[model samples]
Target: MVGRLDGKVAMITGAASGIGLGTVELFVAEGAKVVAADIQDEKGAMLEKRFPGKVVYAHCDVTKEADIEAAVKKAKTEFGGLDILFNNAGISDRMSTITEITAEGWSWIFDILVRGPALGMKHTAPLML
Candidate 1:
């Protein structure tokens, strides 16, 4: 029997660790070519080594549109096309109270959690379709 993702190409942000890493593992196991993008270069490189030819890693700080754009371009160049995009890059502040959340803290969280995903989607949506 063939895997559900056989021959498909997928791009997953935040893929150097946690949920994103799990998704990348499963996608590759199911026979999809995967592009794993994260800001963590060392971890991403380790993941790429683990998966061999089935996976590629892009060092991307998702808060920047140019970085996200480069990741998408890498995906297309490496895998030929993109079929799935997992917008999973995010950061958490876990502030105890509104007063505890500094302006800079809020800005950082929003930049990572909201703007990052938005930029990834904006750059990758057209490529996926």
Candidate 2:
């Protein structure tokens, strides 16, 4: 039987490790062409090596629009067209309360967790649609 994602192209951010990495692995197993974007160059390289042609890596910081754009572009250029985008890049602040958080701390967490995903969707939704 053919794989469910045969001929589909997928882009996954934060894919160097953890959930992103797991997603990439599963996508590839299902025969989707995958672009794995992350800020961790070394780990990204390792993933590329492990998956060979099925997985490509882009060094991306999801907080930056340019990086997100480039990653999406790379997926299209490499795999023809984007069919799925997994905007899973994020960071968490383990701090206790809002009052305990400094202004800069709030900004940093929000930039990574909220703004980054928002920007990824803003850029990627059009492509997917």
Candidate 3:
């Protein structure tokens, strides 16, 4: 039988590891081409190699607008279109209590978890539609 996501294209952030990586694997298994974006260069390369043509890895630091835009472009170039975007990139001071987290830590978390996804949506909207 044909897969549910057959012929779809997906761009996923935080895809070098964890849930994001899992998403890439599942999407590909379901017949979608996936663009995996993450700052973990070594891990990202490994992911690209693991799936060969089905997966492309983009070195994306979600807090940076340029990286996010480049990721969208990479997806379009690699697959010719985008049908889905999974803004899975996020960070937090999990080692410390909220009250004990430093200001810089708060800023980092907010940038990655909030601003990143918002900018992702803005830049990738055209391609997704």
Candidate 3, residues 1-129: lDDT per residue as tens digits?
799999999999999888998999899899999999999999999988999999999999999999999999998899998999999987643646868889888788889889999999999899866
lDDT of 2 by residue, 3-117 (tens): 8999998989899988999999999999999999999999999998999999999999987889988998898788877888888887754654866889988877888888888
lDDT of 1 at 50: 97
Better of 1 and 3 by TM-score: 3
Q: Of the pair 2 and 3, which is ahead by TM-score?
A: 3
Pairs that clash in candidate 2: none
Worst 10 residues of 3 by lDDT: 90-99
**Candidate 2, TM-score vs. the true structure?**
0.90
lDDT agreement of model 3 with the native: 0.90
- Candidate 2: minimum summed lDDT over ten consecutive residues — where? 90-99
How well does model 1 score by local distance difference test? Answer: 0.88
TM-score of each: 0.92, 0.90, 0.93
Please write out the lDDT profile of model 1 over residues 2-87, one tens digit for every residue.
Answer: 88899999889999999999999999889999999999999999988999988999989987888988989998899897888898
Q: Model 3 shows how many backbone clashes?
A: 0
